[model samples]
Target chain A: MSHLHSLKRHLVARYGAIIAITVLLLEGLCMFAIRSYYVNTIEQVLSNRVQLTADYYQKYVPGVTPLARAQKLLSSVDKDEVALVEVLDLQGQPVLDSDGFIADYRHTTPEVSAALNGQQHAWVGKSPLTGEKILAVAAPLCRDESRDTVGVLRYSVSLEQTFRVIQRLYIYCLLVGLIVIALVLALCYSLACRILLPIEDLTIAAKRLGAGAHDVRVRQRSQDELGQLAATFNYMSSQLDAAERAKNEFLSSISHELRTPLTSIKGWSETLFSGKLVDKPNQTQLGLEIICEETDRMIGLVEDLLDYSRLQVGHITLSLETVEINDLVTEVYQQLTIRLSERHIGLTLDLQQQLPLVEADDDRLKQVLLILLDNALKFTPPDGLISIRTRFEQDIVITVADTGPGIAPEDLPFIKNKFYKGNSKLPGSGLGLSIAQNIVQLHKGRLEIASPATGGTTVDICLPQSTPWTAGTYNWTSKANSTRQNLS
Target chain B: MAKVLVLDDEIRIRGFIVVNLESNGFEVVEAASGEEALRIAHTQPDIQIALLDIMLPGIDGIEVCRELRQSYPAMGIIMLTAKEQEQDKVSGLEAGADDYVVKPFSPNELIARVNALLRRVTLVEQVSSSSEELICDPFVLCVSEYKLYKGEKSIAMTPTELAVMEVLLKRSGKAVSRDELLDAVWGPDYFGDPKIVDVNIRRIRRKIEDDPSRPFYIETVWGHGYRWHGESLA
Candidate 1:
């Protein structure tokens, strides 16, 4: 609103000044033309009168006395015509006046003396008698036989009426110029407002949205480009609103997820340290068991977060190796034997002895295996059936299926998205599936999940047999070194 | 022994609470969800306290607190919540929870807060046998039945609110300091926040006083405590 209002100021300065100056110039030109036209008409009429009177005198009045000729010309002048008639002697003295008075010729104009010297001339100035603006023309009279000038014929007309008309034209031009300036100012102001008002609204809305007032939306006025911009602003604002909501929800869920175990561990440690359970040996043992299990849960959460961070920055790399799938499966099964027996879940593994060695990272493969088995154990109730198998048909395939409650159809599509823990209440950091997909993709493999109609889920990991290909290397954790030692 | 219901989705934390309470001379009952807790509360009418965790799978603890308060106004409720969920704490308190213990709290702080709330919200039949009933204008206190009546109609109040009203009525027309009220309602050795007294008094006034905003029966002495204007009749 101040002078910093650049749009309005720009419009008025760039075009408004131009229009104002053009109008002023046209008005000035019009006034000048009118004044000059009136004055020129007066001069032309006076010159024509003097020339005609001179010719008449050359034929008839040259030989008469100068006084008698001046009298005769004054008397012959028509009363209705505006031009005044005067006759002058050879000495530039007035011999006859149309107003019927003879007075000072000491202030004689050059045109009068030049006419007496046998020439013709005209002058425009104030009349010596009444001080009225006038145009005067003078010419010499001659006889055809002698060829010498005898007297001068002069005609003068007052220009007051012509100047009055020109002054009126100037006033009219001035009024028109003022009106034009006002119109131009109004036009510039409207044009600037039309372009800038919506933009200002968008700016304010965008600022509020940036400040985390995510539900803000700009007002849309027209179907023009600015209106489209406003629509986009509104759309973007809603998207930010949803994202902020999701982020907060995730924070709250993550906060609860992290705090529960911390509470258990902290509570157990405090209980154990108090030695109040010292006499109750079973309670003390139970406290120590909970502390260790909660510590392990914390470790898993940290590992998932760390892996996700590394994966996001494109830093995860696989140390490719020739590996036996059955051996890896057996090792993972051995790792989970205690957990499986605790839940009384039965496992059936069918390993293909002729399976080809696939190029993969052993440590990462172990992590994916652990994630699948852990998910199975968490979801499956006691005495449920769990099965694992490996087969080869152009690619090595491994499937881990659990007799557990299958995922909802709506939730299956987004199950692999990062931090997308859809209304499921299981107790993991929601990054395991996403990380598993990334790991499989790094190995040129595919991960597929399916929920059969018999109320269970099956996950398939298909690893393509690499043709001993090599291209690039990235820095990864040093667990590859330990795996290499074991394989050797 | 005091009987308490421990409701939590996490098995380990629930065990911790149960063990702590059991060793401190309390009988413990456990429920894994809001549905189970409500079921247990319906079956067992004598449970004196319920310790609820705010975050659970089926239904949140605040809803449970509301339902419990609606049905059993005298039951003492305590919320166990994470420290970062500050809004949950306020909502829990507004849902008629007597106190809250932030997660990762020391065993001593947890027990102390729990015991302080238990004292205010529990009826201990150890009053002197001298006065069987106390009477004031339009109000009657039945010490034998542990009830209050306004013009022959009983006013439903939580144990904590009734205890505060009883203290103010006992020392009618005398300014009782906040500390003095705290020691009377809670035990003398109870080291906890005194703000619980104000919350209880407000709840009590809402039930008895016509306008809780401008209280007349119980007057607050500026920079001190409350004074009851009634003359006690026993």
Candidate 2:
């Protein structure tokens, strides 16, 4: 049952309207062939009978009376049962008749008149006397070799014999055509299904991957396009599996690293508060200070882990708020001023005055900028130039450039990947750029990485300037809508 | 001082509980395991309240509660669970626990629940005195000393038990919430298990009636808490 359903689905998907049109085309071609064969055969048989009667007349009674000559010719030919032959005049009168017209001759038929007018013609119609279908053939008669018209020769044969032959041929052709069409359909369906089966497998594998099955692969092994697709799909699955394994290891290591410090901090803090360490005041104070520092470390590690996890699970819920983008950038700069000054990194802020408030999650944006700036500071050596530039070019563009060793062409592509620590010789969790990328994506923004011709990497953040502030309001007008637009 | 049984695996938690209860005028008997708890429950069958930790080593706290409830029907059983999940509370209550407290709970709150359960039970026991004017199931209360009499015999009840009975009689056939009782008896600052109301009700029923399983005057209302029926009052 399922096979039948899938076959129906396959036909609907692959064959569709093309099959219907092809069947109609084949049917039309078969009908034309059958009709042509029947008409050609009838004309050949009719002309043969006509020629034989004309021959009999010329040979049996060549110089005799036209009436008796025709009569004798008709009797001899009619005796053979080939046809009922008659001779008619121009005035709708039968001058000579074999079997006395046989009650089957119709004077009003086109074939009769055309014969009397010295024109050769043949047609199929119903006989008036027998009420049977017949084919009538009419040919003009000329005396000897002269072109003058005399009486006309009209001969008709019952179409039952020709029809019987045609009916048999038709049934045979129909049976053969149907068998051929069925074979073609079967072949087409099999070919379509073979091509689509691997695609269906790949679709299922993609769904499984989305559902967290990192090892899902399309394992079809034919050396066709679909097979190559399956091979590529398997490769992707392996890469994902490796990445997932590494992520799990990173999480485990981070958990252990954070938990050790947290355990010490919580244990010691509680002991000190409970007066267990009252005898060693100086040691207790130092322990308390160390606990505070470890707590901050734990917080930072947990924040990084959370950002990474959120990105992995695609569950970073953004609570967008309206804020001055310049103000936010300035605040981040001020917060990192000491570190920037220590590294002698120059901060350049070119803000468009009275710029419209940007709609974003301020905290997340700050985090992204902080990560980018930290990257810049780490990569740039002390006393080297680090420039943070902001502009409103078709959008709000923020670029952080540093004077450092340029990234290798190969490493540039994977710089934003989790745990991808490039040649900075700096110790980092390697989650900074990845988290920034995720946050930027969450805001529906873009992050571009450009390496200068000489050295250093320049990272640009672009956000849309024109956004709908309200249901029917633009960002520049209506302060209320501006608030909402900035929130977006 | 009322005899209280404390069961917990953690020594510090037990120590804190004992110190708090003792300071609040409760003579606490400590036990580390369910077996030890059962031994204590057997030796001191008159222990007013048994605080059993659900995650005890040997026979867990639910079993201990069941044993205590079977043997000493008047003893208040309050199970201690680590989390405040509904299933845990429901199961603990269904397993014949009069009340439950989620840890790490404040020692002061635990002591409050213990004191409330004791006071409520003693009041019900004391309410079974003479005075046929106020008829409540198989017990009669002497309105003068707030004493109770059950089948011509005087039954001892705590002051809180008498107050609860008085409130129920005043608003007979009405359902009351734990918050209402805490306001009326333990004052508004009472921050303890709301299951204290169930514990008190169970204790009161045991003291005044022949069978607490089929409580006549004080009836359970299932999910909405408890109700007192005037029709059940003799």
Candidate 3:
């Protein structure tokens, strides 16, 4: 669930950032284009009007003085269309002004000077009289049939109306762009959420599955890649649920089967040991030993099944403490030496001296060692050599090798599966290797089994010199400590 | 020899217990189911104790124990339970069983429990004949009746609790160690934990004392055992 929440947040942030940036860029470009187009159109209109007036003055004004021609043109032009109009002569002195004749007035504007030099020019400046921004254009007046510059004609228009139009255009474009951006953001948000909804569902279902709710499944809502993933998740959970049920059923039945015999055996043994069968000395002696051996076997089987079940359900806890590997090996060897002797098997121990103390669950590690030794005792023939060897490398490695008939290639792989009883003639529950492997794994160690065709089987257990502390390990240790305190 | 009713679904286990009980001088009656056990119990009026297996086909041992307690209030009941079904033992006790023995238990332990219960029965009979009731102020112990009265309210107790209270009331104002109480109640041959006495004492105090922790009648002699305050009511 937390994973799903974080994924939703990440998707929203990434898509939202992209959409916002794209909208901003597009709005900026549109505003610039609109402003430039409006300004350029106004400037072009003013320039064209100035040229047309100059041509009309040159053509229709019939041999009059330059001042008289300028006055006639200015009187004909509309004042609302053009703010200021002036006529200048070749000597850079103002010939006529729309405001009226002024004494010693000179038109020294850059556009007027450029026009007198036979160039058409446009300028934007603040009007000297009105103090408003204005666009001005100046055109050269030429003599008829000579094309020589005679006077300059200038026309200027206030830019306030044009600016107001541009401002309105800017606001309109921004409104449309904002609406489109909001729509796009909403679409993108919904699309992203729709795209991630199935994945989020799968994540939540997977969490439930991991927490042992095996029946949980994701709903496939669409025929997309995410839908396929959801389908796969559902299939996996169903498989897990089936496997769990099968295992539980197997364990329950096996426990019932194992306990029934154990109950009878233990009951009769206690009955006989309670001196009820004391009349026959020899028979009682043999019966007592048989009872003892069978009871031990039953106990071994029960412990193995319990250990496997605990490992399966993740209930196995370890009490970690420093342990000398050599000492531990020697102790296991001593505990099993009697059994090995009873089977008439020769034993050898090759342990390294002064081995370092490895952090592990001492009792669980010993259980692993005993399981290996017991297996070796069972498989090895009389007068066969059984070697218990230890090496101090990067890790502590302990190997129990037996001179027994090697496991068949076909049976080797399934040997560690619980209740996979290979060679039914061999009297054992087949949980030995699996339990040992689980115990070794709990200590952050590894167990390997190798059997050769030449009649030997070797089991190696490698344990790390030190294990890092984890939350799981801490919880197990604390639980173990509390149990110990209760016992004390 | 006391007549003991043994009920178990497993024939072999039932046979084993019957043999063990018979050899130990108890007259044993065997029944395979709750219905059969009830029938035998009703027909045999002399049945003094019952050993019931908790798991049965029709009615479980707990139900049978409850039914038997209603019918025969004086009959001693011991439940036989599997080791894993510990909850059954507590339910058995609540249903009026006096004690429980886990299955696959040693034959000697079973025999010892039966003998101890019958011994307590005989002791109660003897006490009733000697005295109707033993009174130690606000508390009254009717030995023959197997009941304790606090003020005017009578409180029913299990056989184990009754035995322990009887021993303490007999020697009121004197400290009796846990070992002495266990010997008197569970018997000298009882190989169980001595903590059994402490448990029964706590049960008795819960029933008769206003405050079990600061017990008014059953006072704890530190490091020794319990003593009953023997001041009589005016």
| Chain A accuracy as TM-score for every candidate | 0.69, 0.53, 0.53
Chain A, model 3: TM: 0.53
Please report the interface RMSD of model 2 to 1 decimal: 11.0
**Model 3, A1-488: lDDT tens per residue?**
57656777777777777877888798889888887787788778878788888888777766478777777878877776655777788866777777876437665667877998999998877766568878888899876767899888887778888888888988888888788778876887787778788877877787788888979988998888888888888899898998897577556445544554454466557767678657756645654565565578678777777778777766677777778888888898887788778878989999988776687787888888888887787778899989999998888899999998878889899788776656533446677788888888777789989998887999989887765554224534334445765698
Candidate 3 off by > 4 Å: A1-13, A44-48, A90-94, A101-133, A142-148, A160-256, A277-488, B131-141, B148-156, B164-234
Please give the ranking of all candidate structures by TM-score, highest first, separated by commas.
1, 3, 2
RMSD (Cα, Å) for all candidates, in order, is 6.1, 17.4, 16.1
Best by DockQ: 1
Candidate maximizing lDDT: 1
Clashes of each: 0, 18, 0
Q: Which stretches of candidate 2 lie over 4 Å from their true place?
A: A1-19, A33-44, A79-84, A88-95, A99-135, A139-152, A157-488, B124-189, B193-227, B231-234
Candidate 1 deviant stretches above 4 angstroms: A1-20, A44-63, A66-77, A88-92, A95-107, A110-122, A137-153, A182-247, A311-420, A430-488, B83-86, B117-131, B143-146, B188-193, B220-225, B229-234
Q: What is the C-alpha lDDT of each candidate?
A: 0.80, 0.71, 0.77
lDDT of 2 by residue, A6-104 (tens): 775777556645665676678768877886788668777777888777655544555477767666666676466667677766554567677765333
In the range B1-234, model 1's lDDT, one tens digit per residue, is 888999989999998877888878889899999999999999987888999987788898999998888788778888887754557766787777777787866777778777877876545344424445668878887654556788978886666666777888888888888999888877686664566667777777777888989999988888888999766433
TM-score (C-alpha, index-matched) for candidate 1:
0.78
lDDT of 1 by residue, A1-488 (tens): 35337767888788889999999999888888888888887788788878887777777563367777777767767777777777877776778778887756743877887887778988888977779987889898777678798777788887788778778888888998999999999998888888889888887787787786977988898899999999988898888888788678767667777888999988888877877798999989999999999989888888888998777665676776777889999888887887788879987787989788877798899888888877778788899988888999878998999999977788899888777777877788888888988888777789999986678889999998756444223323345444654588
